[model samples]
Target: MTAPRLKIFSGNANRPLAEEICKAIGVPLGEATVTKFPDGESFVKINENIRGQDVFIMQSTCTPTNHHLMELLIMIDAARRASANRITAVIPFYGYARQDRKDQPRVPITAKLVANLIVAAGATRILTMDLHSQQIQGFFDIPVDHLFASPVFFEHVEKIGMRDKNLVVVSPDVGGMKMAAAYATLMGSALGMVWKKRTSATTVESVNVVGDVDGKDVLLVDDITETAGTLINAAKVMRAHGALSVRAAVSHALLSPIAYDRLKGGEIDELITTNTIPVDPRGLPITVLSVAGLLGEAILRIHNNESVTGLFKVKGF
Candidate 1:
């Protein structure tokens, strides 16, 4: 029998990234109308028939998180009702991921709740990147293809010749030590960490550095940054420790107004991140790398029933 046709649709959250992914895959983005009704409720209409075809819907639960999340769920339901053979939710930036655990009294595990919603809406699989916590994958009963932004970051670091510098990969917090260590090992650099205490939801107090950063260029690696509190505090501490320069390689940059102000404070020389969600550099020393090709390749591999492990391989490493 002939293989099912591949169709990729996108919600309003990150249409440009979806378009770029379609470009990389050499396919046109599936036609869809995603909008709000007169009452501001989410609405989705699949313009084309997807019966017996493999369907993928791309959406990032970023700013206006609730609205985007609703759009994704509605889109998935539409595809399922349309009799699509398979439905994949391509969420480059999965929101509510930090709420995976009930850290507070009478709190909810919203991440798991979101997972259940997606599965209930008929998404057979999930394709996401750089979750706040890796264990979030277990929240889903379906297969999850969790991709990392490290390969993309590695290529950029090498291209910019930063890999050859006297570099040390530093985790902005103890919680991110594993990710920092992986980057350090892959880049053949030293590893460091910053001990910090959360002062508030939008602030952090970096207490001390765990490893030597003196006379070395420090690269702080973290999974996400919103108000830029953790990163700025870490950079300041690294500078005080006599580091030559401070840079940050964050996977997702959900920059808020305060984040832009802190980033402009110049504690960090450069901020490197992915276009998982929409990012506006505003002419700062920020570099936004496209993961479209990476995601596009994964989509193709999934449609073809192949392993996506090879995408993790960085050149010359």
Candidate 2:
């Protein structure tokens, strides 16, 4: 039997990344009309027929989170109603991911709620990269294709020849030790960590560095950074410990105004992140890598019913 036709579409959010993914996959983006109404309501219309076609809607729930999310839901609903064979919501940056659990009383697990909403909105599956919490996969009943940007970062590591130098991978906090360890192992570098305390929503205090970073170039790895408090504080601690230089590789950089302000302070020598969300470096020492190829490959594999295990492997480039 032949595979169903593949049709890729994009919402208003992160359309540039979606276009890049389409380019990588050698496919044209589907035609759709996504707009807003006078009352500030989302409106969606499919310009072409997609009946019996496998549909993938690419949208990152980034800035103006609710607007992008609603657009995604509406697009999925439109595809389902239009008789698409299957629909996959490709979210490069899954927002509200930080609220995966209820750490305190009277707080809602918004991440789970978002998962439920996606499932309820007629998404047959989901494809996302570097979720804030890995456990968010369990929240959905449908299959979730979780991809990582580590391969992209590893490529950058090779491009800069960091693999040949004395290097250490540092986690910004204890919770991110596993991610740091993976990076360190892949790069053949030592592992370190910074103990941090969250003083407020936008402030983090880095208490101490766990491993020796003296005279070594440091790479701080984290899943996501918004205000950059954790990264800046951790970089400061690493430098104070006699590290020659401090750099960071984060999966997602949801940089706000405060983050840009902090970056100007020279706490870190460079900040490497993915194009999962829209980011502007503002002439700062920030590098944005595109994950479109990685995501495009997974989309092709998933559509072909082939194994996607190789996407996780980090081979020397």
Candidate 3:
């Protein structure tokens, strides 16, 4: 028996990342037409034959979330109908991930719903990174390859000499303590957290800090950031507590206009993030690292039936 050929396609969400991934894999990106109709309905047509081939669709459900998500689903459906042997959805940034639970009355778990939609669209596997919540993988009945941007962040942190700057890793909120602790452990830095109360849907107030950060170079870590309220507020609190410098390392940076304004307020000295979503720095102190090599390697491993566990190993100094 022969192995099925691997093909990769991209939606309008993050085509550049997809192209870079293909470059890393040394394969040409599968040709496809993914666009919206005049009525705003998505249309996808596989330009090349993919019958009996393993297919991967790369799309980030970022800004214009619903449109990009719909585009991904449509593309997956197209690949399935093309008789592809296997279909994998590569979502670098999974939108609606924050709505994974029913914290309020009569609200839907949109994250689970999104997962169902993908599986129903005939995706046999899922590849995503730094989801807002870990349990979102449980919503899917298929195999899920959950990757983290920490290793990539760690490499950059070392490159910039942040590892030896009296570094202390702090979670902007209690919910992200685990991720922060992992970074602290790997970097051999002190671990801390900020207790915050959500004043509104878009605002957050930092109540207290859990660990010592005085006179230390603080690094705030989180899986996602949109309005930047939580991070900026936490950085302010860290500075108020006598921290020498404050920086942020977020996996997904869905920076909005308000986030830009807050970032410019100087609470955070540098914002390090991944290119999971489209980010516009607008002349701020933002560093965007490409995860193409990381994702591309994972795609190849998946196609070749290899373990992706090795991708998680970050070299510590």
Clashes of each: 0, 0, 0
Give the per-residue lDDT of model 3 (tens digit) for 210-301.
89999899999999999999999999999989999999999999999999999989999999999999888999999999999999999999
- Which window of ten consecutive residues has the lowest lDDT sum in model 1? 156-165
Q: How accurate locally is residue 129 in candidate 3, as Cα lDDT from 0 to 100?
A: 95
Q: TM-score of each candidate? A: 0.99, 0.98, 0.98
- Candidate 1: which stretches are off by over 4 Å? none
lDDT (tens digit, per residue) of candidate 1 on 174-259:
89999999999999999999999998989899999998999999999999999999999999999999999999999999999999
Which stretches in model 3 have alpha-carbon errors above 4 Å? none
Pick the winner on lDDT between candidates 2 and 3: 3
| Cα-based lDDT for every prediction | 0.95, 0.93, 0.94
Candidate 1 clash pair list = none
Who wins the lDDT comparison? 1
What would you estimate as the lDDT of candidate 1? Answer: 0.95
Candidate 3's TM-score reads 0.98
| Candidate 2 lDDT, 30-119, residue by residue in tens | 999999999999999999989999999999999899999999999999999999999999999999999988899999999999999999
How big is the positional error of residue 66 in model 3, measured in Å on the Cα after superposition? 0.6
Candidate 3 colliding pairs, count: 0
